[model samples]
Target: MATFNVNDIRNDFPILSEKAYGKPLVYFDNAATSQKPKVVIDALVNYYMHDNANIHRGVHFLSQRASEAFDNVREKVRAFINASSEKEIIFVKGTTEAINLVAATYGRKNIGKGDEILISAMEHHSNIVPWQLLCEEKGAVLKVIPMNDKGELLLDKLNTLLTERTKLVSLVHVSNSLGTINPVKHIISLAHQKGIPVLIDGAQSTAHAPIDVQDLDADFFAFSGHKILGPTGVGCLYGKLPLLEEMPPYQGGGEMISSVTFEKTTYNEVPYKFEAGTPNIADVIALGTAIDYWNNLDRPGAVAWEEELLEYATSKISAIPGVRIIGTAEKKAGVLSFVIEGVNAMDAGMYLDTKGVAVRTGQHCTEPVMLRFGVPGTLRASFMFYNTKEEIDCLMENLGKAIQLLQPQTAL
Candidate 1:
C-alpha cells in the first residue's frame, strides 16, 4: 500500500492551488462534495474529445468504445464494494435518487398498510423524505431509532423497533452533520435477525473508509462518485442480487426494456431495468478514473492522518471559550461540527470566507439532528485525505478572528 503524503496528494487536485477570498483556499466542506483530481478531469476531456458517442445502441467504432468504457465502470464499482456481481450495481444521479429508486420500487411493493419503516434520527433529508413519501402512499408508519447527546444511535431501543410488521430499515452509515460513524455492520446484523432488509446510506461513509459490502453483509448500499473524488451526477447503488431482481423498475424508457410490443412492454434485466433513459454517459465513464484515483491512494493511512487532524482541531477549538463542539462521539469520521456562542453560523461562515476558509454553515440537511442538539445550525468543517494539520491551525486562527469580529465587546 502507498503511504500518505499530503503534499503529493494535494498536487494531484489542481483546485487546491487556487485562491479564494484573496487567500489560499482551505476547503473543509468535503462532506458536501470533494474536489476532483486531474486524472478524473482528463478522463472527462478524453471522452468528449475522442470517444464522443452514445452507448449500448450504435455499432460504430466510437459508439462501441463509449459503451465499453461506460460499462467498464460498473465492473469497477462492483469490485470496489466487493459486491457479488456487476448486475447488482445500478447507476443513478446520486445517493438521493438511489434511495428513492428502492423506496419507490421495493418499498412500494413490500411495505403495505399498517406496516413500519425504520430509520435513525441522524438521517439526511434524502433518507427521510423518500420513505415518508412511500409511507404516505402506502399507509405505512415511520419508526425512528433515537440517539443520545453524543449523537450515537440508541441500539438498545432497536429490538423493540424491529417488529414483525417492520418492512425495511434505511439508515445512514455515517451521520453527515455529526460526523458520527454508526456501527452499520452491527446494525445490519441486528436487522437481519428479524429477516428485515437494511439499506445503508453510504454517501458519507464511502469516502472516509474502505467499504466491503459482502463483508458487511449489507442488503443495499448507496454512495456517490463525487464524494469519492469522481464527477457529480453519477452514483451507484449496490444491492443483493436476489433483492434487486425482485424489485420493480424505478423508471421506464430505452435501454431498460427487453421487448416493446403494441400490447405490453417487457422490462430488461436486474440492473438495467432500474436504469432507464439515456444515462449520464460521460460522467459515468469519468467515475471510473475517480475510482482509480481512490484505489491508488493509501486509504488506511489517510484515515489515521485525518483522525489526527480532527483531534488536533477539536482540542484547539475546545480551548476557545465560546466554541462548543456538537458531536462528541468516540468514533467519528472526517467532520467537525460546532457552534460559537452568540454568533450566527452563517455570519461566522462569511467571516471565515474572507480568510479563504470554506466551511458549510447549515443544518446539513439533517434538521432532526439540529433540533436534537438545540442549535439552529452549525459551522461544519469536514476534512479529507488531502487536508493537513497546518490547515486546521489556519482554521482555528481565523475562527478566533471571526468570533472576535462578531463580538467586539467580548474581545475588549
Candidate 2:
C-alpha cells in the first residue's frame, strides 16, 4: 500500500486552505458534513454549465446527456456498496429521507398492530423518529436495545428483544454522537437467523470505511451523500431487489409512473418507482463524482489515518483535567465527544468558533445519548481522513481556552 499523505489530500479540498476569523481554520465537524473536493465541485459546476436538463423521457441532446449521467450514478452507488444490482439503489434527499422512505413504504405495509420494531438506543433522531411515527400510525410497539455506560450495545439483551413479534430491526451502522462503530454485520446475521430483515443507517459508517451491503445481507441500507464528501439533497436507499419489487412507491409524480390514466395507474420498476418528481440531477451527478473520488483513494490507508486521528484526539482530550469524554466504546470511528467542567457546551462551542476552530456542540441530534450519559450536551470534534494530528492539537488548544474563558463566566 502507498503511504497516505494528509497534506496532499488536503490540497484537493479548497476550503481546507482558507482562513476564518483571521485564523487558520481547524474543521473538526466531519460528522455534520464533509468538505467537498475540487473534483466534486467541478462536477457540479460542469453539470449545470454543460448538461443542464431534466432527466428521463427527453429526446433532446442535453436531456439525454443529463439522463445518462443521472442513471450512471445508480450503477456507481451499486458498485460503491457492492450491491447486487443498480435497480436496488433508490435516490432520496439524504439518510433521513431514505429511512423515512422505508418506514413509510416498507414499515407501513408490513408492520401492523402489536408488531415490534427493534432499534438501538444509540440511533440518531432520523432513525428513531420515522419508526416512532410509523409505530404510532400502525399501532405497533417500538422496542430499544439498551447500551452500557461505555456506549456499547448489550447484544445479550438483543436476543431477548428479537422475539416472534419483532417485524423489523433498524440500527445505526455507527453512532454519530458516541462514534461507536456497531457490529452491524454481526447484528444483521443475528437478525437473519430469526428470519427478520434489518435496516442499517450507514450515514456515519460509509464515509469512514468501505461497505458491502451484500456481505452484511441487510434488507435495506440508507446513507447520506454530504456526510461522504458529496453534495447535500442527495443520498440513496439500497434495498434488496425482491423486497423493492414488492414494496409500494413512497410518492406519486412525473417520473415514477409507468402509465397514468383516469381509471388506473401503474408505477415504474424498483428504483424509479420510489423516485418521484424531478430529481436533484446536478447533485446526484456530482455524487457519482464523489464516489469516483472516494474510489480513487487508498481506502485502507485513509481509514487507518482516521483511526489514528481519533486516537490522537482521544488521548489529548482525555488527559485534560475537569474534562470528561463520553462514549468510551472499544470500537469507534473518528468522533470524540467530550464535556468540560463548569462550561456550557454551546458557550464552549462559541468561544472555539472565534478562534476559527469548528466543532459540533450539543446533543448532536442524539438527545437520547445525552440523556443516557446524564449530560445536557457535549462538544464533539469529529475527524476525517484528510484531517491531521495538527488540527487535533489546534482543537485541544482552543478547547483549553474555551474552558478558561467560560468557566469564569459559569462561576459568575
Candidate 3:
C-alpha cells in the first residue's frame, strides 16, 4: 500500500506529469472525469494483448480466461461497495444508464398514474431527465426538495414531500457542481420509513469516500468508473436482491436470457437480467484494477489532504476581487465552483487552459442548480487526492490574470 503523499500518488497517474501547452498540467476537472491511473491503463492493454475474447459465451481458452477476468470484477465491485451479494451488482455503461434502468424497470412496474417521484434540486440532468420521462409516461408527478442558498437541501421539508403517493426517492450523494455532500443516509432512512425505496446517484461521492450499501441501507446505488480513476464506458449499479428480482429487465438481448423459443423467451436471473448485449469487456477488467489501486492507498490520509486542498484553494480564490464563490455549503467535498463578476465563465475557462490549468465551465449537467443559483453557468475546479496546494496557487495566479484580461474596463 502506498502512503497518501500527494507527489507519490501523483506519479501513479501518467497524465499528471505530462505537459499541456508547453506548461505543466494542473488538472482540476475531476468532477467531469478523473484521469486514469497507469495500473488501470496497463490492465486495459494487458487484456487486449493477451485475453481478447468475448465473455460468458465462448468455450475456448481465451474466452474462459476473459470470462473469469470479467466475472471477477463483479465480485470486486460487490466487495468495493460492500454489497450483500455479487448478484446485486449489475454492470451498465455508467450512472446515467443505471438510473434509467431503474426508471424503466422498477418504476414502470411499481409507479402508476398520479404517483409522485421525489428528487432534490441539485441533481444532474442524468438523474432529473429519466424521472421526468417516467413521470410523463405514467402520468406521475415529479416533486423536488428545495435547497437553501448554501446548496443544502432543506431536510425539514422531506416529511411533507414523502407522501402516500410518493413511489421513490432518488438523490445525488454529492452535488457535482455545488460540492455539497448530501445526507443521503438520513434521506434513505426517511424514505424507507414511508416504505418508499431510495436510489442514490453516487457518481461524485464514490471516489472521494468509502461506500457500504449495507451500512447506508440504500435500495439502489449507481456510480461511474471514469469518475473513479478507471477506464470510461463501464460502471456499476448495486440493487437489493429482492427489488432486482421483482423488476423487469431493462433491455432484451443475449446474456440476459435463459432460454428462447420462437414464441417466448425465459429471462435470466437478477443481475444478468439487467445486462444486455455485449458488455464493455476490457474496460470492466480495467475498472477492477482501479478498485485495486483505491484499496491499496491510504484512503483516510488522501481524504484529509483533499480537504486541505479545497480549503486552501477556497480561501485564496475568495480573497480576490471580482470573484464570487458559488455553492457555499458548510460541508463540501472536492469541488470549487465560482463566477467572475465581469468575465464570462467560458472565456475564463479557455484563458485558464492556455496557462495549463484545466477546469470545466458550463452548467455542469446541473441546469436546475444553475437556475436555483441564478447563474448562467460557473467555472468549476474540482480536485482529487493526488492534487496539491501548489497546483491551487497556480490556479489562483492564472485566474487573476484571466479576470483582468476579460473583465470590462470601467468608465474612465
TM-score of each: 0.98, 0.98, 0.99
lDDT of 2 by residue, 1-412 (tens): 3467898899999999889889999999999999999999999999989999988878999999999999999999999999999999999999999999999999989999999999999999999999999999999999999999999999999889999999999999999999998999999999999999999999999999999999999999999999999999999999999999999999999889999999999998888999999999999999999999998898988998999999998899887888999999999998999988888999999998999999999999999999999999999999999999888888888888877777855434
Candidate 3: residue 385 Cα off by (Å): 0.8
lDDT of 1: 0.93
**Which of the two candidates, 2 or 3, achieves a greater lDDT against the reference?**
3
Q: Tens-digit lDDT track for model 1 on 1-412?
A: 5688899889999999989967999999999999999999999999999999999999999999999999999999998899999999999999999999999999989999999999999999999999999999999999999999999999999999999999899989989999999999998999999999999999999998889999999999999989999999999999999999998889989999999998999999989999899889999999999988878888788888888888888899999988989999989988899999999999999999888999999899999999999999999999998998888999999999998889647444
Cα RMSD for candidates in order:
1.1, 1.6, 0.8
Q: RMSD to the native, candidate 1?
A: 1.1
The alpha-carbon lDDT assigned to residue 362 of candidate 2 equals 94
Clashing pairs in 3: none
lDDT of 3: 0.95
* Model 2 collision count: 0
Q: Which lDDT values do the candidates have, in the order given?
A: 0.93, 0.94, 0.95
Per-residue lDDT for 347-407 in model 3, tens only?
9999999999999999999998999999999999999998998999999999999989999
Error of 1 at 404 (Å): 0.8
